[model samples]
Target: MTPNTARRNEASRRAVLTAAFDLLQEVDYAKLSIEGIAARAGVGKQTIYRWWPSKGAVLFDAFLMLSEGAGGEPPMLPDTGDLEADLVLVLRATVDELNDPRFEPPMRALSTEIAHDPELAAAYAERLDGPLREAKRQRLRSAQQAGQLAQGLDLEVAVDMIWGPVLNRWLQRTGPLTTEYTDLVVTTALNGLRPRGSSS
Candidate 1:
């Protein structure tokens, strides 16, 4: 495509994703339609259809875009050489995100889609979850190298152990998904991950 056409296509894509997210905040997902999204985005219905296969896909892309929260490179969690502090920062931020009105609706929506749609769940793993998990594990690896964690500890399980409780509470609504809750999770999980005799 020509440069102008490429830019226009990208602009339209951004508009559609943004519109999809905004509409979910205003209306229930059942009321959200491809036609409505197209109208809100100021693009033709075919334009949205050309880019995304379904309403869920548009919403999925929208969720991803917003979760990223910025452009250029994927941002990494702060590595201050203090593993406990870094983990608490990350999990507490997750608490804030799960509590966000702007994000909750789409998060619930995406969770629903993934549960029912295996293909979408697979794509979510590949596109969003995989990269984020890798980054988290990278942080954990750094801690291990610095002797913050047990040398034989499995980072994969460590990642899940650290973040899993927060996700379960958020998804199941079993309890408060608060910073205090996540703070406790980090403290508890880190206690296990820390090397013997290493002060947390």
Candidate 2:
């Protein structure tokens, strides 16, 4: 496509995605449809089909774009050289984001839909979880190199240890997310999982 055409296509795609997101905030994901998205975006229905196969894919992409921001890069995880501080920083930001009703609903809806739809779940795992897991692995590797983590730590397991408790709490609404909560997670993970000889 010509540069002008490419730019127009990009603009149209963004318009549709934005409309989908707005509709998600306004209506249930189960009630959302391509027709509504097209109407809201002022784009033809064919324009959406030309790019995405289903509303699930469109909503998935829209959520991904919204979560990742309009920019291409994933949101940064902090790396302040103090692993405990860095983890707390990022996780607290996560807590804030999860607690925000706007961010939480779309995520919850998508997660619920994925649970019932095996194909959607696989696509989500491939498109979202896979990249996030790799990013967490890199963060854990950096901590390991800094002598902050136990030698031969399983990076994937380590990521789970850090994320699992917080995610459970968020999903269950079982506890408040506070500085105290974050401190406990960081301290517990380090002390329980890291080598005894390792220093904070």
Residue-level lDDT tens digits of model 1 in 1-200: 99999999989999999999898899988788999999999999999888888888998898677667767466588999888888888888888888999988888888888889898999899988887898999999999999888899999999999988889889999998988888888888877654757543
44-130 in candidate 2: lDDT tens per residue? Answer: 999999899888778788877765675666534667788888888878887888878777777777777787889989988887877
Residue 140 in model 2: lDDT = 76
Spell out the clash pairs found in candidate 2: none
TM-score of each: 0.87, 0.79
Give model 1 RMSD, 1 decimal: 2.9
Counted clashes in each candidate structure: 0, 0
Off by over 4 Å in 2: 1-8, 67-70, 73-76, 193-200
Compared with the true structure, all predictions reach lDDT values of 0.87, 0.82
The top-ranked prediction according to TM-score is 1
